[model samples]
Target: MTIRTAVMAALLGAALTGSAVAQSGGDVGGVWQTQAGDANVRVSKCGTQLCGVIVSLRDKIDPRTGQPAIDDKNPDPKLATRSMIGVHLFFGMKPTGANTWSGQIYNADDGKYYASNVALMGPGTLKVEGCVGALCGGENWSRVSR
Candidate 1:
């Protein structure tokens, strides 16, 4: 093949690969949870952007007290709400740059929405942050072992 043709082909291939990598988002697809709070979340793509949702509930057990974690905020007085499962407890995310995404975050505890951002910390970890107006908080999620 001509040198020009070969160069063009190589450039085209590189562009395609870059685009795919950007869309796939390195390693953001998986289950993630926090160490300190109840932020167990699963990351997935909503349309073209990455998003997270609560899919499982950690068994109700307190680490320090070895007692069952009780849901003190449950609206129903008698119903046990310590662990919530299968809630669409997050919002969609869009790519902002390399390994960074901006989106909306939903708090399952209170059903509130806020500004959200996420970044891949490692191969199986994602650092997720959410902001309430101006103040922000974040959590580190380890990839769930499936």
Candidate 2:
């Protein structure tokens, strides 16, 4: 009877520890540097989902204007003059998997929004994919400190 009680307690403890690990497995909140090191985005909870904003740029000056870059390529006239800083790269990113989120990603370089998904490849790596029609490509983004 004593041995059986001890075994049951051990099993229960293991199960509880596993649950704690599971809870931390899906956390994707942090700053991530783009594969090209062109930009860094800060991702966090928007409402119920997640969103990322442009926090910095490697080249702050736009050669065309010889000043800080703006979203001149954006189709909307109102947004054309908007500054590149604080631009929403992705919003309404819904959880598609335990370690992935799917949504649209804004590309300021081309002034287009592509179907995209982000997944955690490891503790310090994230895979970001963008698709145009049938052609899809992705790159690994490294997690960065705030």
Candidate 3:
């Protein structure tokens, strides 16, 4: 093949490879349902990082009071009265590797922040892990359609 043809072929191959890499990395922006099926979080880009907000909850009422749930567990008294819905629980997640991100996650249940990592296991599956001190736990979340 002529030199020109060879260079063109190489460029085209590089472009295809780049596209595949991007697709394999996956997009984290979407709605994901927690493993317990208790909540659905909407993940989206916040500046250059990713953030997730509670969009829906299986139980909206506080069992003890029969009123809408609040972030009463939050350590900060000023924030404790805020509604749980629309609360940003995942923050500043930066891409760490292909299909994976690292950041911090706030556990409203216990009112604590933990080092967190998330990975897209598949087109519809996500693995989320949170570590506090030395102990760590994780759960698999599924993509929510609409």
Candidate 4:
């Protein structure tokens, strides 16, 4: 083949490959329901990395106060009074592989941060795993909105 033709073919091949890789990664920006179906989080790009924030809760009212639930469990005393809704629970998640990301997830229930891995199981499902020391647990979250 002529040198000009070969160069054109290489450029075309690279473009196609890049497009395929981007598509395979699958966008995780959306609202997802936790496995227990008690909470919903919205995932979106926060600067260069991805972050997830609590958007809704099945039990919205604080049992003790009969008011909206607050982040009473937060380690920071000042932040403890902040509402749980719209709290960023996951942060610094960057794509690690096709459909996978690594980050930190904050567990409001325990008032702790854990090493977390997130993966898109399918177009509509996400698997979120958090590890503390040697113990790890994961839950499948369904996409609630895009």
Best by lDDT: 4
Please report how far candidate 3 places residue 80 from its true position, in Å.
Answer: 0.5
Clash numbers, per candidate: 0, 0, 0, 0
Question: What is the C-alpha lDDT profile of model 4 across 60-128, one tens digit per residue?
Answer: 998899999998988899999999998998877766666677789999988889999988888799999
- Listed in order, each prediction's TM-score against the native is 0.63, 0.78, 0.80, 0.81
lDDT of 4 at 21: 57
- Put down candidate 3 lDDT per residue, 4-81, tens digits, no spaces: 999999999886665455345677779999999999999876655678899989999989989999999999999999
* Runs with alpha carbons beyond 4 Å of true place in candidate 4: 1-24
- Candidates 2 and 4 compared by TM-score, better number: 4
Worst 10 residues of 3 by lDDT: 16-25
The alpha-carbon lDDT assigned to residue 83 of candidate 1 equals 47
Ranking by lDDT: 4, 3, 2, 1
Compared to the true structure, candidate 3 yields what TM-score? 0.80
**Residue range 69-88, candidate 1, lDDT tens digits:** 54444555563444455455
Q: Local distance difference test, per candidate?
A: 0.69, 0.81, 0.85, 0.85
Q: What is the full ranking by TM-score, best candidate first?
A: 4, 3, 2, 1
**TM-score between model 2 and native:** 0.78
CA deviation > 4 Å runs, candidate 3 = 1-24
By lDDT, is 1 or 4 better? 4
Per-residue C-alpha lDDT of model 2 across residues 1-146, encoded as one tens digit per residue:
69999999998887666544433455567899999999988877665456889889888999878999899889999998998999998855766555677788898978899999877788788888888987889999888963
